[model samples]
Target: MKLSLVIPCYNESANLPLLLDRCMALDSGSDIEVILVDNGSTDKSLEVLSKLLPRYSNCRTVRVETNQGYGFGILSGLRAARGDIMGWTHADMQTDPQDARKGLELFDRHGDGIFVKGRRYGRPIMDVVFTVGMSAFETLLLARSMWDINAQPTMFSRRFFETWQSPPHDFSLDLYAYYQAKIHGLKVHRFPVRFGERAHGVSHWNVNWAAKWKFIRRTVDFSLQLKKSMMVVNI
Candidate 1:
């Protein structure tokens, strides 16, 4: 099946060259195309991508004129994707973009009735603790087992994506998509992927305890909203 990988680059100028190189490695076959979304970057990211993207036969871009939330950028790329299988990873290069290939293998095995995500490894201990805490909270709050809510390379069939309604336009999109997969009864698959440092810039979030707290608050709000929607649906 054709696969489109949407990577959102927000002011990721320094990492573009190397990121594109790594993406080139994924383009060795015809079934994959990478959509690098220019998420309203104020840096040289757009210029660098303009010059570099053409060199990679399997890559293109969608421009979001203003910097929106993380999920907004991803949704932009998803809307432009031309693949039967679609998903997204980060531009920070914290995880190998090639890991999506592993996700693709799962789809090849199980067909479109599956939702795939990366289970990150090699992260800092505090991050792991944080992930576990959040996962537990979401699982209880949403009444569904939600592990690794923010994992990379979240892949699914276009049919699954088309079912998404009123998906969040922030980092909470990860949780939204994961929860949707569970609620829809799609088989969930997780693969281990090594998480590492960014190749260039620091994270927009995940920088400090304060940022983590903010993220937690927003996610909790979104989770509650999701639960309310579920209740309405069941009514």
Candidate 2:
């Protein structure tokens, strides 16, 4: 099966080269395409990508003039993907691309399921606090159990996107996608994977009280909307 690796980047020029190299080493056993979605970076990220394009036959870059949110960059790559299996990772190299080989093996063995999400390890204190707070809030709001909903190395079948409705355009998009998949009776498996801190650029997340409140509000609204939609269909 053709495989596509989508890397969503924003001002991640420092880590792009290493990320590309790691990805190119995956044992996909089929044609592999690496799609780099540049999310309106002001740095020399685009130029760096241009230089690397000639080095790899399957590497391509898609540039967005405006700074769309993280989810938008992922959506852009998904739209342009030409592979049977679709996977995505952060451009910061926090998650190793080599883990992708294991993901592919799981997919091959399990046939088609919902998605394979990586469970993070060795998160910083701030990251732990944010993740715990968000997970608790989402659990309370959605009445569902989840682990690592914000994990980076997420892999799924390309068919998942064919019927996926528009997700939120913010950091919570990952949570939204998880809930939507569950609502559709899709199976989601969590795989233990290694996680490292960002190799270069600083994070863009806000871990304050305001961010917490906003997350709570969005989770409740989206959960209720999904429940209402299901009821309407049942009626």
Candidate 3:
């Protein structure tokens, strides 16, 4: 089966070249395409991408004229994807692209009704705090358990996307995606993966109470809808 890797990039010109090189080095067979979604970067990201596109035969870049948030870029890339299995990773290269092969292997074995998600390690203090808090809130809201909901390098079959509908065009998309998977009774296998600090850029989260509350509300709403849908399906 073919694999599509979606990378959402925002002002990531400094890291794109190295990220692309590492991604291209992965041994995920020959049927892999890397889709780089530029989220209206003001930096030289597009110029750098243009220059490097010719060097990698399996890599393609698309530029969004306006900043459409993280999940919006993911949706755009998914719409453009042409593979049986699709997944996403950040452009910062914090998560190794080689780990993607492990996810693909899991998919190859149990992908018919499973979503392979990565569990992250080596986060900074603030990130650890944010992730732990978010995980607790998500578990409470969904009445289900998830490890590292914000982990990068999540892989899902194209069937999951086709069945669940389009994801939210906002930061809460991951929560919604996971909730949908659970409601549909899809098996989610979390694989341990290493996370590294950004080699060039800084993170955007401020890790305040407001962010936590916003995430909680979004997760609650998604969970309610998913529960109702699953009940109807069961009936």
Whose TM-score is greatest here?
1
Alpha carbon deviation, residue 94, candidate 2 (Å): 1.1
TM-score of 3: 0.87
What is the per-residue lDDT of model 3 for residues 110-218, given as tens digits with 9 covering 90 to 100? 7557887889987777778878877886677567886688786877888888986656777667777787788778889888888887878875543566866776676
| Residue 5 CA displacement from its true place in model 3, Å | 0.7
Kindly list the per-residue Cα lDDT of model 2 for residues 35-135, writing each as its tens digit. 88998898999899989867866667888888878888888887889988887878877788777667777778887666778888888787787778777
TM-score of 1: 0.98
- Candidate 1's C-alpha lDDT? 0.93
What are the lDDT figures for the candidates, one per model? 0.93, 0.77, 0.80
Clashing pairs in 3: none
List the candidate 3 regions with Cα displacement exceeding 4 Å: 27-29, 206-235
Report how far residue 45 has shifted in candidate 2, in Å: 1.0
- List the candidates' TM-scores in order: 0.98, 0.87, 0.87
